[model samples]
Target: MSVSTETRIKWTSADLELLPENGNNYEIIDGELYMTRAPHWKHQTSIARITNALVSWSNQSKLGQTIINPGIIFSDDNNVIPDLIWISNKKLESCVDEAGHFTSAPELVVEILSQKPNDIKRDKETKLKLYSNRGVREYWIVDWQLKQVEIYRRYEGKLTLMITLLDDDSITSELLPNFSCQIRDFFL
Candidate 1:
């Protein structure tokens, strides 16, 4: 699981403090700082499409607020930057921390899987379990390469695959009530 990169920096709260207020994104996983180079064009397109769809649905229907690329602090030492998160306003207010960690997990978290094989595996399996254990009721994994989005639902203390949505299909989340997205818009 290690990429053996010499240029990487170890992460700490100080490093987090030192980050510029610029729009660049970073995630701290177990004391390792993982900085994102700008996501590719297709990735950005997909991200925007999903964010727009979720926000529109949530706002009009009153399911929850659509949060885009916010820092989700999983622990004192672990901070995650999810691509999209949908949290009820009540949840958002209750979860804010003095240092800006999301103390509470969102009801739905969406991760757009990168093309790298390690990333694909990490998002599909490791992150899915992590979110489920952390009480995210719905986890969506969007695979650009595969042209599919896998929706996972937490049931009876475990997460099970609810559906694999193809490009022509429309997918919705149970946690957010009426939030839905067209599958093709994500890949287009």
Candidate 2:
């Protein structure tokens, strides 16, 4: 009888740079690597709708910037490209590095759920815990198929589910003052 020992490879930000410039999306979470193919048309449309709303609000408020598919590098071992991110000008100045990658958590991170089971898990469970632990003030999980948005706000030092806005309801964030959008807008 023989005993075998196996060591898992821990991925880092540097490893991501070496990948081919294909359309695939790759992320390193807790030193593990995860990949996803290009998003569907519906996903892209939802992102566009959400981005437009956030951009319009931010422009008037002059509070921060709404970025689409920004690379948020929380650590060498935890680099993720969220669907969208909203970072205040104050926090943005400190978190963004010379390379234009966020070195810390943004004020709000938005992720659109895919139909794939693994992708859904990565967004809901893996990324939820990651964002909560890393001090993301707010997180939104947008489900296109279900046409709902799950909002998580930081409470008691952890991201807690505050609400789920249905198509009939409007989505609002405490992090974004005076910002509200009809949930139906996301699908349309």
Candidate 3:
């Protein structure tokens, strides 16, 4: 198949109102529209594992809630469907609008990189910069290929590399306070 080189059509959060309910993941980054195909089985499994771990911790602590594929609008031109979003209980109401979408940045955004080269590159570079610039408290990049998870936390006004965990290591969040999971478990 030939790779398309056409520039994407510009879009805003308002444009999402016209879109029908579909399996395709629609997002807008810096005013450009991007449509991602449904995730593969391994990708879905990894997401589920992370969600499972977060759910257990959040439930017991009453710290917050973990949601899958929530529309997070950082700006009119920057709308994204994160793989998993965590909102702390304190700011959940203020962040989420009446439409059940987050109008502001969530505390944490998790992205499980796919096997596709374009997506892999975008998550590591482009999205990392976007989330950091938008003031997301933490960002997690999960790489099944390398069996590792990279956590970035806001520090000194920029997102800084907090920790890089291998499959054998566990992810612990000081913000979450007692929340953790084995990196290997997230892949399984």
Q: Model 3: residues >4 Å from true position, as ranges?
A: 1-9, 19-21
Model 2, 46-118: lDDT tens digits are: 9999999999999999999999999988889999999999999999888878989989998999999998999
Model 3 scores worst on lDDT over the 10 consecutive residues at: 93-102
> What ordering of candidates by TM-score runs from best to worst?
2, 3, 1
* Residue-pair clashes per candidate: 0, 0, 0
Model 1 scores a C-alpha lDDT of 0.78
Candidate lDDT (C-alpha), each: 0.78, 0.94, 0.87
lDDT of 2: 0.94
- Please, what are the lDDT tens digits per residue for candidate 1 over residues 47-156? 88888888888778875788878778777556788888889877877998896658778988899987767666767776676787789888888887778998888888
The candidate maximizing TM-score is 2
Q: What is the lDDT of residue 65 in candidate 3?
A: 94
Q: For candidate 3, lDDT tens digit of each residue in 23-58? A: 788888888777788877889999999999999999
In model 3, what is the error at residue 163, expressed in angstroms? 2.4
Model 3 steric clash pairs: none
Task: Report the Cα lDDT for residue 120, model 3.
Answer: 83
Q: What is candidate 3's local distance difference test score?
A: 0.87
Distance from true location, Cα of 183 in model 2, Å: 0.4
Residue runs of model 2 more than 4 Å from their true location after superposition: none
